[model samples]
Target: MMPIDRERSDADMNSLKRTKLAYSILSIVLIVIGIYLIIRPQTAMLTVCRVLGVVLMFYGIIRLLGYFSHDMYQLAFQFDLAMGIFSLVAGCIFLFRTEWIAELIPAFIGVIVLIDAVFKIQTSLDAKRFGISKWWLILILAVIAGALGAMLLVIPLKVVEFVMVLIGINLVIDGVLNFWVVHDTVRMIDSL
Candidate 1:
């Protein structure tokens, strides 16, 4: 019984180690790809759009067929079905005419960032209601984010370079954060 318990414990430890290793690898890969997308926005966007479109189209078709065949089709779920079709159409447009669609990528990202920054800034202001000076950093970062977003709109040419640099900075930050988390988790697991 003692030997059996020891073997089980060893196996459990090995499994936990494997899981942590996998998570670390996955996090690193995601961060790398994110950085790559920012560096080569046009190409990455084109590829992602095309792939997404194809997947959405297929999903739509599958859902549409199920909707007709199944008696339990809900109206709310139909919205998802419609969205899939829309995604497919949008993807097809980008896949076929990437040059025109490519322009939309930067603009869309810019608008998203602008909205995000505005929200962050607002949250920071709201925090000021509590009289917190730390919120000032959030406000400053928000302004920087909005400025970077505006740069994309005001000067499209430089946006690519800015995006690349921003991505590099983000990746470094994310990598460091993830590394710390991974290290802590490993330590905790080992302590167990």
Candidate 2:
């Protein structure tokens, strides 16, 4: 008799592949923007900071609305509330303190890169868990991302242009890997 203890179905496989495809596409866009940043480091830093500030403020407004509008998971809701407030404050700092924030943009980018590297690794693992083919490729990409992120953090930002170059290179490579992931996901979907 065949064992009948598996959770995967065709639908699950399709869903997984689709999700990875979407994620890969998004990563590709971000990577392209990153390349632009590399090309114009100083200006890009200001733009990135401004964008972040706007995002934070928008997120804060959304979250703050949630408190009044709907019921949320208790723990998650609490966390959201806290984060919403924090983001609002942080956003204000970024917007109002442009000069100070400008000075810290490199550090901010480093921290963001480092954090994203950790998530990319986890995302790679998640793809593997879903039985995506050539999952190891994502793992390799994750490793590369981690190394690049670490370099951003560990290296001093004495020369802002140097930091930009590193970031640019990382983004270009990241974008390339994203496309690879997309291609692999598409192949997997076709096979399925």
Candidate 3:
């Protein structure tokens, strides 16, 4: 029994080490890709656009099929059907207009960011009402995000370089944060 337990412990240790190694590699790779994307914004944006187009088309088809397969209320299906059509059209437009998609990518991202910031601001407001400490921090970050998004939307071309730089900074931070994850995992494994 003692021998068997020892063997099991050794195996677990080995597995944990391998997992740690894998995570470190993944984090490094992501950091590299992020840096590359920052350096070559246009190229990265184009690749992203193509992928988005394919995803949109795939989801659109699924949506259409699901709506047609079940006889739902015409009123509900009408909205769903319209959304599906819109998705399909947008996807096709992306697939065919790669350059155009690239040009519009910043604005699209900006819109998403702006929406996210608004949601964050709302959450912070609720937090403030609840007497949560540092709600203002969230509000501040939200405001910054909204400002950056607005810049992207209003002057995409001008903001393109800034966006790329921000992406690079985020990636670097992500990579650094991943190191913390690895450290925690290692500590947990030791505890186990």
Model 1: lDDT to the true structure: 0.49
- For residue 188, give model 2's deviation from the true position in Å: 12
Model 3 root-mean-square deviation: 13.0
After superposition, candidate 3 runs with Cα above 4 Å error? 1-36, 39-42, 51-99, 156-163, 166-192
How much does candidate 2 score in TM-score? 0.56
As a TM-score, model 1 comes out at 0.41
* Residue pairs with backbone overlap in model 3: none
Task: Please write out the lDDT profile of model 1 over residues 14-133, one tens digit for every residue.
Answer: 654554454356346536654665666554555654543454355444434323321221221223344445545655665687667666654543554565457556656655654544
Clashing residue pairs for model 1? none
Candidates sorted by TM-score, descending order?
A: 2, 3, 1
Supply the global lDDT for candidate 3: 0.56
Q: Judge candidate 1 at residue 93 and give its lDDT.
A: 68
Best by lDDT: 2
**75-119 in candidate 3: lDDT tens per residue?**
112233554576688778778998987878667656645654565
Best by TM-score: 2
lDDT (10s digit) by residue, model 2, range 34-107? 77777777755676667657755764654454333322112112234654586588677778887788777656
Best to worst by lDDT, what's the order?
2, 3, 1
